[model samples]
Target: MPDPARLFQSLSDPVRLRLLRLLVREELHVQELVAITGLSQPRVSKHLGLLRKQGWVDQRKEGTRSWYRARSGDDAPGGTALLPTVLTLAEELPQTDGDDERLVLALGARQAQAKAFFSAMADRWETIRLRYAQPEFDLGLMGGLAQPEARVLDVGTGGGALLPEFAATGARVLAVDLSLPMLVRARKRCRGQAAGEVDFCCGAAEALPLGDGACDVVQCAMVLHHVARPARVVAELARVLRPDGRLAVTSFCAHHQEWMRSELAHQWLGFERTEMERFFRLAHVTPGRWLQRGPRSPDGSGNGNGPNAADWPEVFLMTGIKDADHGG
Candidate 1:
């Protein structure tokens, strides 16, 4: 066989390799990647362009801007497995920084957009909040905390949709949002509840204000899509979980078809079982079980009723535990 030297050359630099790693987790705009990698916009774009020519990356255009994701092959369903050794190699390498840090690049752009997105829609938040964040989903994953008194942290609390469900579960809830206006709406939803019980805060998902291992369980609803650095967010969620804490995070997995792409713009990445497993690995979170639900709107667009039957089978739900052993 020919030498594999040329194959290795494409991913030689820690920076280029790191960019590919981020692409695997989610598709990302080159401009947005600047924050994650701490590199200039041109530099990130250059690396992405090179990766594309190597057939190791692919680009999807949305409006005027373009986003890049790892291309396994032909956009086929279950393509995540096509480059396993590359992914495995990526997993073992130490995380790079400055011009090669994925977290730095991913979070900066996303938090700003998320904050702005929520702030503008604050008025209509309550309607969206009441819709999709269901307790039956959380209770099903973590039944131990069904009591009248439990504590939960709804990370990426968005407009506080999951907060009330958590509160209804007898868990005194803390809803944190990067957008102050969004928090205001969440506060409005919990106004009738006693003070100090259901509370809200203005914060980004990467750096939650709560103390370490502060709550019994932490939840993130469809909001994972809004996050730039999901692995770090998961790490933070794991950080705040009690040793035996449970985590229920819902994320969008790519549909088995290429046609679903146009609708979920800004939905940079979709997870496969391995992809999800890798995310938990980076977060030090562990997967418990995988579940599937209807094409319900993650943004809470439609009535809380499940997604139209036509959109069924493409959506999925994943529940994981913060393994006490995995905690640092």
Candidate 2:
């Protein structure tokens, strides 16, 4: 029941059509569109305004940038009926070589900005990370398995973010980190908390200082990417865990954000679910379940856009249990 006349009128403009075509591929800010289309900011904005008026595009603002995406299916008003046809036509058109070149340049610029920001704030990384909205996962589920006076080891306890969560279960918590400064910050964060006493230790993930079968529950949050030998770390975790002990790991999934390697000191981009499972198998642990969590807006907004929206990483939780037959 859409107005065909309005839909046709909206697509009549070449600039608007081109903008829609580009937006259909991925959400883009005005600056990216300007670069991709080789159009002046004013001209791009003019075309975008017309498209917005026709309900052919949707916009989400994050800080100073406004990201726009083409509306399709039920989202497009007058064009809903012809959305498929329009997308097909757009795909059939040949893309300009210059547009592709400009897109590459724009992507590189995004990587540079992220790298500089991370490099400048490496010491206060945790504080900055907390500013963004993170996907919510129930760590409390692990608490139910805790027994009386259970020994829990938190590997790579950066700023003790998950220490309090584990401590609240009345488990004796041991926090480990490679950086002395990070351990200091973690200690301060856990001070005076109602959770049971927490012990801090300086250690490498690949070579933990604790003895064999030292812990009942091991939690590693967002740390696997930083270790040079992930398999070795997994082996160490398995070695220190008692038979039937639990292991919980949270980390980014494989992504193409190459800047993370140099700027954030990440050794790996991330691990796929199968790769994580294989690591567990090699460590003589039984893999449990894998849960994927996608990125969200920084302010808990549901607009699917934020300051880090362009390169936000997807995270996952992989759990496993040490096999009783293969005791450490």
Candidate 3:
């Protein structure tokens, strides 16, 4: 818990307050904060160091990159009204509106970088993916989610992993991806799989290119790690799913491999299963089933890249159902 007087004092600086306002909305890298605030790197670091010490901000470092966000809810400072009060007053500050605008650009830059990376790697994405594991077995595990003649939406269906499996189910499958090259590859790969139709759409996961309640089953295989905002993508999945529709997701478990961010264009280094559950709950999707493939050490550390394949981290499958009560 943060001391009451110090916590309040932390918000006393207009400069520090501005950083909090941006962080409360989105987690930002240190360089991004410098750019957004138009401040020197040392100044931004100074302010962040203070907020961090006061327990109003949280920080994470991956390799050389560092990300910071305002600590909120149970992790935030004790006073419930502190952030709300700070944010309300901060909005009137001259820098608030510019911070919002710069934040959008920063986030957009992230998505654009991901798009470029996937587009470039489309031809050999499968080769890169195999380094993790053969994902077909993982996809096949969720095959039962598709019913005959049901509408299935496969987000991030890179190289058509989920398409061929679902094609035999007699379900109408829709494959979506932001990379045109990836979609082209997926279409060609699944063309002769004996499926009648598999529609391919070029779209990002954060804002799926589909109408509300448009799907009976939505599955995203190994995709959450690639997107800039995984939680928002889950909400978008719920938006396209009809009430009681099934949602299946597969991805690598949390790992320490920072190299994946540069080599594989992974925005996140996988996620904890608990984080996936929280995403489902926030999206009004009820988690139903869980499975894991691959291996993990006793300490829950994913120490892959070692000589033995046994050192690899596990890939997990999680299934959820869109709730009827969700307004989506």
* Strongest candidate by TM-score: 3
Task: List, residue by residue over 1-328, the lDDT tens digit for candidate 3.
Answer: 5567877888889999899999999878899999999999999999999999998888987546788888887677875766687789999998878888888998888788889988998988887666555455555544668778889899998888768778778889889998999999998898778465688999999988889999999998888888878888999999999998999888888876666777667777777878899999989999988877774332443345542345445788889999987756
lDDT of 2 at 75: 77
Would you list the C-alpha lDDT of every candidate in the order shown? Answer: 0.65, 0.74, 0.82
Q: Candidate 1: how large is its RMSD?
A: 7.9
Model 3 TM-score, 2 decimals: 0.88
Candidate 1 ranges with C-alpha deviation above 4 Å: 1-107, 126-135, 138-149, 194-196, 256-270, 296-315
Q: What is the lDDT for 185 in model 3? A: 93
Candidate 2 lDDT (Cα, whole model)? 0.74
Candidates' TM-scores? Answer: 0.65, 0.59, 0.88
Highest lDDT, which number? 3
Clashes of each: 7, 0, 0
- Per residue, candidate 2 scores C-alpha lDDT tens digits across 22-54 of 777656789889989988999999889878877
Candidates sorted by lDDT, descending order? 3, 2, 1
Clashing pairs in 2: none
Error of 2 at 235 (Å): 0.9
